[model samples]
Target: MPFRPPPGRAAPDPRLDPYRERAGALFDQGEQIGVVYLRIDTFWRQTGGHLWWRRWSEPSEQVQGYIEFNGGGFDDFYQDAGTMVAEIGDWGHGRFPYRGEALQVRWLDDEESRQVRVSTFGLDDLQA
Candidate 1:
């Protein structure tokens, strides 16, 4: 049997699920505000792992856009306290943009937001 996509969008691949690739595409070379989930977990394992993150102490209200990751600093995938930006876009029709790569080794900084851009990052579609 052939798998069908939801409503108006195509289906995502099961073998390779790219996470944050889509969000990067929305960003332009200008000052723009967006929202991204300060994830509590990334690169988790079945038995044991090291990418465990902690939530923020001072909770903030969830608005249309603008999610901060002020969890001090993290070198690994544990993004509990650190902030991540969500590019303002329509996350609908079973299709959401995200980064496929781990988004590491930043070199150049985003001019507008002053956020560092991942030198070798890729994107993918998120299907729910």
Candidate 2:
């Protein structure tokens, strides 16, 4: 039989279901911010297994947010996060903006240990 998408969007692959579950858990662990959840869900649907993340409760940088690992050695998900942030227009830190925070992503198994910050760059930069 031919495949049909859901009411609003295309249907995601069944094989990628686990990734969605993990992504949901990670988002919840990271505090269940709505915009973040939507973006993360989009990322999961598009790339399948591009992310593996969990919440961390540390005093320093990894507080009240998620620590994501991209074993693929690329920042596609990070770029997606930035794009979503810009689209959502939730850049300012406050209640109006979704979560008022950006997610911290780390390239796992790579030589460098530095974390890449994803934030709203600006809508003007998007090509029309």
Candidate 3:
């Protein structure tokens, strides 16, 4: 069954729903499942932006990826990261390829400051 938020609580970002099942399977296998928070900001030329990410379960494991902004914008900036992590868990069992590897990715839009809070869990972190 799909997940639902508690009464009076805000719903989760719909973009992440697709990966819940996959993440659950990983959890059952005793894999380390976590979330990745990404902060993105486009450059003046709109060519690309800085993409910084870190695993929620491991604070010291932080990395950056390249973001090339073409003509169109992204439906969700963190979608790629989420998908990458899911695939890694499914195929590599938490071991990611050299190209793109991460936990369930969520975008951070903090205009006030560049600082980002590393709190929050992914699908696997939820108790069934």
TM-score of each: 0.18, 0.19, 0.19
Cα RMSD for candidates in order: 15.6, 17.5, 17.8
Query: Could you give me the TM-score of model 1 versus the true structure?
Result: 0.18
Q: lDDT per residue, candidate 2, 3-48, as tens digits?
A: 2212233244343332221211122344532221112232222222
lDDT of each: 0.25, 0.25, 0.28
The segments of candidate 2 whose C-alpha lies over 4 angstroms from its true place after superposition are 1-7, 23-128
* Model 1: CA > 4 A from native: 1-20, 24-33, 37-66, 69-90, 94-128
**Which of the two, 2 or 3, has more lDDT?**
3
Per-model tally of clashing residue pairs: 13, 0, 0
The best candidate by lDDT is 3
Model 1 per-residue lDDT at 88: 20
